[model samples]
Target: MITVELTRFRVSPGLSEALLAARSAMLRDFRADRDGFLDARLVRLADDEWLDIVSWRSSADLAASRAKGGNRPGIRAFFELIGEIVSSEEGTAVEEAV
Candidate 1:
């Protein structure tokens, strides 16, 4: 089953450009390095708050990715841009009509 990993965080003031660039770099690294990465989305909840919804092929894949995320330069850069992480959660995605 697909696993959806959701993360919410806030960025410091006047760092939107750097944050976007860092996110882009991280996405490229994830695509190249992480297995079972299906897709991801970055959503803005407020002026400085944001949400990241990432879908993996399975729970194992998500776990594997998480284990290596902090080691990757792009992922590290992305996190550096975040002032604080508000929340994080993961679960099996509910099936939907397609």
Candidate 2:
């Protein structure tokens, strides 16, 4: 089953652009190097608050990726930009569309 990962976090005020750039780079790296990256999306919940939704082929893939955190420059840069992480959770995807 596909695994859906949701992470909610806040970035420092006035750093949205940099945060997005870092996220883009990090995603590019993940798609290139990670084994089961399906896709990812970034959404703004409110000023300074954002959500990262990522999809993987299976729960094991999500766990493996989390275990190998921030090992590259892009991923490390993305991690450094977060001011606070509100929550993170993963579960089986019930449905998916293009």
Candidate 3:
């Protein structure tokens, strides 16, 4: 089953654009080469709130990636820009259309 990981967070004041740029760089330079990584998107919800949606082939793939840690330079840069994590969840996709 496909797995989707959703992470919601708020960025430090005046850092939204920096966070987005760092995320883009991380995806382009790092995540794109990872196993089972399907896609990733960063979305702005409110003035400071944001969402990170990532899709993977399976739960194992997500776990493996997590084990590797987001300690790389680009990922670390992105993480540093976040002020707080609102929520994070992972689940299998439902078959029904929205």
Candidate 4:
């Protein structure tokens, strides 16, 4: 089954741009080499709140990638710009016709 990972967090006072840039770079560099990585979305909910949603082909694929730390050249810097995670969840996607 497809796996979707959701991570919600609060950003530092004025680091939105930097955090976004890092996230973009990290996805660009990492996704190409990841087996089940489908796509990712970054959303700004409020002034300080943000959400990251990632999709994978399967839960196993997500687990394997995460076990390797999900780190690419810019991932560490991306993580550093974010604050504590407010919530996180992962589960199989519910299939439905578009």
Candidate 5:
């Protein structure tokens, strides 16, 4: 199992609602599709920043989804918005050892 952490930042004001709406739509899409995803969570950080933690069965699933255009519209829009704001992304190795 793998997890993907996607974060986005909004600027200029009043963009957070639009971005979050998009996120909600995208989450619905993920829920409808069961093969390519394990689970996903949309999180809000601060007024203009958000994070999406996605769990996948494998990297191949992730790649295949992107290749087949399985990502979300809001996600794409968020990236487009990033070009207008300051944003960064980081992938981490999660250890579930307890």
Candidate 6:
């Protein structure tokens, strides 16, 4: 299993709402994909920062999803709106819970 953590830094104060809206659209679109995407969460911090965490069955599934490009229109608009506000960084890690 793998977890992807995306960090975004926002430029303006009110941009968080827009980011959430974009994420909502993404959830609506990408929730149906196979390959054990599992689940995701969008977390808001401070005035203009967010952490988007996604769980996948494996690294291979994550790569395939990236290659497919999901939903282009919503995604493009989402990126365009929040791109400047966010400097994205991603990583994968093991999740262990006892």
Q: Name the top lDDT candidate.
A: 2
Candidate 3 CA-lDDT value: 0.82
**What's the true lDDT of residue 22 in model 2?**
86
Model 3: pairs clashing at backbone N, Cα or C within 3 Å: none
Q: List model 2 lDDT by residue over 1-97, tens digit each.
A: 8999999999999889999888878988898777899999999997789999999998888889988898888988999999999999998888768
Off by over 4 Å in 3: 96-98
Better of 2 and 5 by TM-score: 2
Evaluate candidate 2 by giving its C-alpha RMSD to the native, one decimal: 1.1
Error of 4 at 12 (Å): 0.5
Steric overlap count per candidate: 0, 0, 0, 0, 0, 0
The TM-score values for the models, in the order shown, are: 0.89, 0.94, 0.86, 0.86, 0.58, 0.66
lDDT of 6 at 23: 74
**Candidate 6: C-alpha RMSD after superposition:** 3.1
Candidate 5 per-residue lDDT, tens place, 33-57, comes to 5456776666666866666667667
Pairs of residues at least 3 apart in sequence or in different chains that clash in candidate 5: none
Best by TM-score: 2
Q: Sort by lDDT, best first: what order?
A: 2, 1, 4, 3, 6, 5
Ten-residue segment with the worst summed lDDT in candidate 6?
81-90
User: What digit string (tens of lDDT, one per residue) describes model 4 on residues 13-84?
Assistant: 989989877887778766766789988888899868999888999988888877766466676678788788
TM-score of 3: 0.86
lDDT of 3 by residue, 19-44 (tens): 87787768864555568998887788
Task: Tell me the deviation in Å of residue 70 in model 3.
Answer: 1.9
Sorted by TM-score (best first), the order is 2, 1, 4, 3, 6, 5
Tell me the TM-score of model 6: 0.66
Query: Which scores higher on TM-score, 1 or 2?
Result: 2
Model 1 lDDT, full chain set: 0.89
lDDT of 6: 0.63
